[model samples]
Target: MQSAEGTTAEHTAAKGRPTPKRREAENRRRGPVAPPPRTQREAIKRMRGNKQSKEERRKAAAERRERMMAGDDRYLMPRDRGPVRAHVRDIVDSRRHLMGLFMPLVLIVFATTLVQNIVVQQYATLATLVLLLTMLFEGFVLGRVVNRRVRAKYPDAKDRPLSIGWYAFTRAMQIRKLRVPRPRVTPRDAAKVG
Candidate 1:
């Protein structure tokens, strides 16, 4: 009744059957399977499906970027979205801001720091710190002005608590050529915002 390993075989006749091939046993262990495409056309068709998904992703990204650039509220960041923010951007863009010179001034300060003269370096550092602090104060004042204008224009806006002032101040600080959602108004139109 017992075989070589001392295990009982309920059906003695089944023991006479040949063992399954290694490959067959392995395939069975692997569970469900599908054969790969056997022809070039089939392979191409399968690859096309993958390509389509990649294309879809690329298109979606492009559309999102376009929406962001166009100032679409849904696609814009929380800080940059809404009508009040758009108006703020327009106001900041239209006017000449003192903070706009910050980057260039900082670059000039950096250049000055490279000088080997000890006294000149000390004076340059002092001057740079003073200039940066002055610019910061100017930005704060400009932000307050922009905030006042925004509050006056949109008294009933639900998002009035958003940092519209800081947003305007930062936008104003950026060089016009590098600003996103390009400035719609010129310096001549700056006076009309309020």
Candidate 2:
């Protein structure tokens, strides 16, 4: 047995200070502390939150998603950020993207092949080939235009011409209504393409 001032084997070092006083705790003390929850529902509710906090978190997340989709710079993905990329998106969005029809044409050609008629299949294949060639030519022209505009606006910018041009081309391939980050300017307000 140890004396009052003597240390025992189980004794550890002191914390060096007393606990902090909380005004909120003093104000909240109505009686003895509440006992632990008893029912399963009560316990699970305590484990998560009474639904209010969970709902608040979910609402906040939804708001953040909306802002991200709205092209807020702070919430934008790395690829979509910066003034140049925003300009490219706006330019692409405001134009009627004929490439948007590529998917529909592909489906149409696929359906035509189901006819089993040699003449129909031949015409469908020829049309597809012609469309592909036209799309490739148009893509090249769009790239040139995008690069030229970017270079003109940001003469001293170190951005790669091919990358910016390719980015513009991809954005232009998307349907206006389906484009992520949504369109800011309508076709009526579109900048003239050179």
Best candidate, lDDT-wise? 1
Task: Estimate the lDDT of model 1.
Answer: 0.83
lDDT of each residue in 1-194, candidate 2, tens digit only: 57688965566789998865796568567556757999998888886875779899899999887998899999888888988888777777766767877778888998998898999999999989987887778778878877787788778867798888888878877766777788788887674532
> What TM-score, over all chains together, does every model reach?
0.69, 0.70
Write the residue-wise lDDT of candidate 1 on 1-194 in tens digits: 88999999896466776999999999899998867999999999989998999999999999998887777889888778778888888888877877888889888888988999988899889988898888889888877887788889999876644377678778988988778766778878977777
Q: Report the number of the highest-TM-score candidate.
A: 2
- In model 1, pairs of residues that clash are none
RMSD of each: 12.6, 12.5
Each model's C-alpha lDDT? 0.83, 0.80
Candidate 1, number of clashes: 0
Clashing pairs in 2: none
Tell me the spans in candidate 1 whose CA falls farther than 4 Å from its real position.
Answer: 1-45, 160-162
TM accuracy, model 2: 0.70
